[model samples]
Target: MSVVAVVLTALMFVLLGPVAAHAGAGPRDTGSQPVDSYANAIRQSVWVDTGLDGDRDGKTDRVAADIIRPSEPAAAGRQVPVIMDASPYYSCCGRGNESQVKTYDQSGNPVGFPLYYDNYFVPRGYAVVLVDLAGTDRSDGCVDVGGASDITSAKAVIDWLNGRATAYTTRTGSTTAQAGWSNGSVGMIGKSWDGTVANGVAATGVEGLKTIVDISGISSWYDYYFAQGAALYDGGPDELASEVESSGAQSHCSAEEQALRDGAPRNGDWTSAWQDRDYYANASKVKASVFVAQGMQDLNVRTKNFGQWWNALAANGVQRKIWLSQTGHVDPFDYRRSDWVDTLHQWFDHYLMGVDNGVQSQPMADIERTPDHWSTDPVWPAPGTAATQVGLKASGTNGLGSLSAGAPPASGTERYTDNPAQDEDDWAAQADQATASKVSFTTGTLASDLRLSGGGTVTLTATPTTTSAHLSAVLVDLGPATIRNYEDGAEGITTLNTRSCWGDSTSGDSACYLDTAADTENVQQTVFSRGWADLGHYDPSLHGVSLTPGKPYTITIQLASTDHVVPAGHRLALIVAGTDNGLIVAPSTKPTISVDLSRSSADLPLVGGLPALAHALRGGSGHHHPTATTPAATPSRGPAAALPTSQAARLR
Candidate 1:
C-alpha cells in the first residue's frame, strides 16, 4: 500500500482507538486531534519562506517549505520532535498550496512523493518540514546537487524551523498545536539526495540538530559518479535523467525549473559548485549521532558512503550504527510499516528527546544474505575471515576440475576471443550472461558448505593476441537446486571502493591489488584508463610480457565486497571472458585473451586457525566453529589437456 494509505490506517487506529467491541466507550481522540478536521489533525499546509541573504545582495533568497504537523501536541508547552524531509527529486507531494502535490518532476517524468517522509513520521508526533529546495518547484535559484549551496539550502530549513515555531503559534494560536507543542528539537532524515544533505549539514554542527538518519546517501560524489578505477555505466544514470527531466517538464513548470532539477552535470553548475564540497573534507566533523542504512545491491551509491562515515564515527568514537538490506536504491525489502515508522521514532526519541529508546542497545548491524539468515556482528565481515581459492583445470567442453599442488603442465594455457557486441540491456547477453563468453571454465560440485561474507579477487596470467584484451569474471553460486551468478570488475565501469566491517576501504593497490586496508571513509576512488598501442609495432618483450605461448603472466580482477553464504551442494564457479558488456574498455583496439592455467590462479589468503583468535576477540556464537585438522588442498585435476597450436586458430 502507498505511504498515504498506511498513514491513514495508522491514523484511524490512533484516532478511534478500539474500533469494535469497545463501542460502549465510543470513539475518542486518544490525546490527539480529530482526523477529519484540518485544524484538529494538523492537516493544513502552509509555505513559509526563510529569509536568507545568500548572495550578500540587499534581497534574500526566499527558501519556502511545507510544514505538516499533528493537530494536537504530543507534549504541551514543549516543542515536538521535528524532522526535515528534503523534498524529492522534484517539488511535489508537499503541503504548499501554490505547488500541486504530484509526482511529476519539473521536467515531467513521474517521481514518487517523499511519502516515506510525509506519512512515516507525522503520526508519531513529529512535525515534518518538506522544503522545495532552491531552483526546484516553488523555490528560487539554480539547483546544485551535492554542492555547498545545496547544503546551505538544507541548513536554511533548520534555521527557519528554529525561529518559525513561535511565529506560527503567535499567528495561528493554540489550534496550531504542533507548532505550539514543538520543543524545537530537530533532526534530519531522508534517503538519497536528502540523505546527502543530512550528512552535509551535520558537518556544520548546527544547534537543534541532534540525530541524522541517512539512508542510501552518498558521502562523496566523485566516488559515486566515477568509481575508483572504473568507468561510468551510461545506462542507469541516463534512464534516471530521462525520467526526471521529462517528468518535470510535463508538470507544466518552467523549462528552466525542470532543467535545474534534472540537468546538473550537463548544465555544469553542479560540477563547478561541487569541486570543493567533497565529503572527505568534513565527514569526520559531524558531531551528531548518526544511523546509516545501505542496500547491498545499490549500484549507484554502493557501500562506500556508509563505509566512509561509519569508519569516521568509529575512529572518532562517535555513536553510530548501520543496517544493510537486500533491496536496491530505496527500501526494497518492503519493510513492515510499524518497524519502519518506529525505527525513526525510536532514533529521534533516543537522541532528540533523550528518551533512552534502547536503539543503541539493539543490534549495531543487521546483515542478511542467502543461505545464511540475518546475523548481527559487532564488527563487519565478522573479523578473522578467510578467502579460499578454488582452482580450475580445464578439459573438453564440460570436463573441468580443481587445482592440485603438483601438476605436470604447471604452465599450460587456454585462449578465447570475446565479442564486445554482446553487451546490452538488462538480461542482455553482454551485461551479465556468463555462459555467452569465449574464455569459459567451470567448477566441480561443492564438497562442503561455503559462505563468503567478504570480497574476493581473481588473478590470472594472460597473453593477448592483440596489444590488449578486456577481461571479465563472475562467481556463481551453483547448487543442485539453483545457480546465481555474481559479477566481477570485468563488466562496464564498476565501483572499486568496498568497505569492511570496520568501515575501512578493503580496496587493493591500483584498483586490482585487493588491498584490505585503506581510508575508504571519504577517499576518492582511483580509475585506470585503457589506452591503445599498435599491435603490429608493439613489442611483447618491451611491454613486460611474462607470459609467452609456453610461459605465464598474472592478471588480477577485483570484485567488490559482499556478505553471502553458499549452501553445501553449491559450486562456486568463476567464468572468464574477453568482453565485459562494453563496460570494460580494452587496453587496445583489437583484443585477444589467452590464460596460462597452471601459473595463473587467484591468490586468496586463508587465515589458518584465525577462528580461534576470532573467538577470543568476539566471543563464541557457536556458529563459527573451526576444524582441528588442517584443511586439505583441493587441486584442480581433469582429463589431459593440450595447448592451442596458433593464436588465429584459438581466436576462431
Candidate 2:
C-alpha cells in the first residue's frame, strides 16, 4: 500500500468505528431513519472527519465528521435536506482528482459525475455525510468487490447519521443534541467504479438506498471484460485494472483488486470466473429506482453492455432509465454537468423527495450530436427499420465476382496457409491475414438506401484442403477515396475472425478445409455490437455521386462490425479469406478452404423497426441455409469407424 492509503485507512477507523457489529434478528433495531428526515433537522451544530478503524479485531473508533448546524430557518419546524457523499477512496491519503475542478473548461470532464453532495446541496436545505470506503483512503476492513464490506460501510454511515444505536453516533451527536428530526432519504450517486459500488449496495437488499445513478458502469464482469467472442487482450495488453484503480487519485484496496483480477485467456475459464461476481444475479432484490448514464465513446463499458443492463432491468420489470451521451469515461459532472445535475435532481426529487417531476415520462434517448437532439422512442434505434441482405455470390471469370441470386459450385478450390508462429505483434493493426488466400465479391449499385447498424456473423459451407482450415467472412463498404470499413458498427476494421480460431492441421484434406473448432452443426457467428472505435461514419452521399454509367466504387465489408449509410451509388463488397485474422487460431499452416455456395448464403432476418432493420442490414448472421440447394439423400447406415480423440474437437 502507498503512504496515502496508510494514513487514510487509519483515519477511516478513527471516525466510523467498527462497522461489522455482527447483529442477529433480535430486539435491538440497528435500522436507521431517513437521514434527510432526521439528521439535518435535529443537529444544531456538528463537526465531521474521516472514519477509520483498522485491525478488524472488533475494536470501536472514530474521527470527527464535517458537521453543520441548522441556520436561523432551522430554528423553526422546517426540515432541511441532508446529503452524504461516500468516498470510494480513503480521504486523507488519496487526492480527490476526479471530484475536483478542472484547469481548463474546453476540455470536457468525465461522464455522469455526481459532485454536489456536500458543497452545493448541503448548505441549501441539505445536510451532507461523506465517508471513505474501507481499506482504501480512510476506511477499514478487507475491501471486497460487491462484498459484505461495501454494504457495511454504507449501513454504518446511514446508521451513524440517523442516531441508530451506534457507539460513534452517540458520541458525535452530543454537540448537536438540541436539533429536531429529519427524513432519512440519502440518494447515493457515483460514476464508473463508484456507481458500480452503489449498484452493488442496492443489489444487497440495503434499506433506504432510495435511488441509484449508474454512469458507464457495467453490471457484470463478463460483459465488461470479455465481449462477444473477442478476448480483450487480443487487441493488446493494457493494464485495464490498474488504469481503473489509478483514476480519481485512489487505487482500490489490495483485497478488492485481487477480487477483480483476471485469469487465463480462455473463454470457458473467463466466463466461469465472471459468473461469481454476476451483478444481475441479485438484481431482482434491488428496491431502488435506477438512472443509468452511458457514454457513446466509452471503449471499456461498451454500449451493448449498457443496453444489456438497461434491457435486463426492463426485462425483470425493474424501474430504471438510461441516458446516452457523446462522451468518454470521464465523470459527467465535469463535462455534461447541466444534463447530469438536471437528471440527478429530477431522479432524487421523484424518488427521494417524493416530487412528481414528470421525469418518468421523458424520452428514453436524449441523443447528442444529431440535429433532432431528442429522438424520443420507446427503445433503441426508433421503430420502422428494415434490413436488406446483399448476397455475396461468386461472379466473373475467377472465383471473385459480383453479386448474383445464386452461383453453381466451382470445380477448383482456394488454398491458403496459416502459420500461427507468425503472429502480428500489433493487435490493433489490420494484418491482412488473408492476403495470400482470399476470394473477393463486389455488389452492384444498391437499389435503395442501405444502412448497416448491427453486429454480424458468417457461416461458410466449406471443406478443408487440409484436415481443417480457418475461414473468415468480411463485409466492406468501399468509398471513393479509401475503403470505408463499414461491416459491424465498429469503425476502421478489417478481416473476419479478428479474435477467434479455426483449422486443424492433423486432418489432411489437400482439396478442402474444415474449421475443427467451428460449430458445423450450428452456423458459426461472431456478433459485434459496440466497441467499434476505428470505424468511420459512413455516409454514401458524402463519398460523391452514385453509379454514373461506368464508374462504380466498392466498399469492403469484412467479417467485422461497422456502422455506415451506404448510398445508392456506392457498391457493397464481401471478402472471404482462409485466414481469420487474430480472432481464432487456424488448424493448419498450409490448408485450402473450398466454399460450397450452393450450401451457404447469408440469411439476414429482415424486419421492421430501426433496431430490427439494423440487425438485418448488417447481415452475416451465419444462419445460412441455402433454400435453393437440395440436401443430399441419406444413405443406409454402415459400421462406424473407430473415433479419433481429435474427432470430438473437430466436430466442435
Identify the candidate with maximal lDDT. 1
State the weakest 10-residue window (summed lDDT) of model 2: 502-511
Worst 10 residues of 1 by lDDT: 518-527
TM-score of each: 0.58, 0.53
Error in Å for residue 404 of model 1: 9.3
Question: Model 1: runs farther than 4 Å from truth?
Answer: 1-60, 90-120, 162-184, 203-207, 235-277, 303-315, 330-338, 370-373, 386-417, 421-447, 454-473, 480-558, 575-579, 582-590, 593-652
For model 2, what is the C-alpha lDDT against the true structure?
0.41
- For model 1, what is the C-alpha lDDT against the true structure? 0.45
lDDT of each: 0.45, 0.41
Task: Estimate the TM-score for candidate 1.
Answer: 0.58
Candidate 1 per-residue C-alpha lDDT over 1-652 given as tens digits, one digit per residue, 9 for 90 to 100: 9999999999987655522211113222112212211123343333343354333335444444556555544322335667776643443333211123434336532233334443444544557676655545645443445554467667766765566421222212333223444565778877666687788888777777778888877776544543332233332222332233224323432433343335334211233333444664575677788888775545445555566566566677668777765443434113222455456656775676555446777777777442123567675544556665545565533212233222245545566565654421111111112232343333334344444554555666767655334565554444332111112211111223542121111111010111121111110111111111112212332223222333334556555445555444443444566544434333334455666777566533222223322222232121111222222222211101111222111111
Error of 2 at 483 (Å): 18
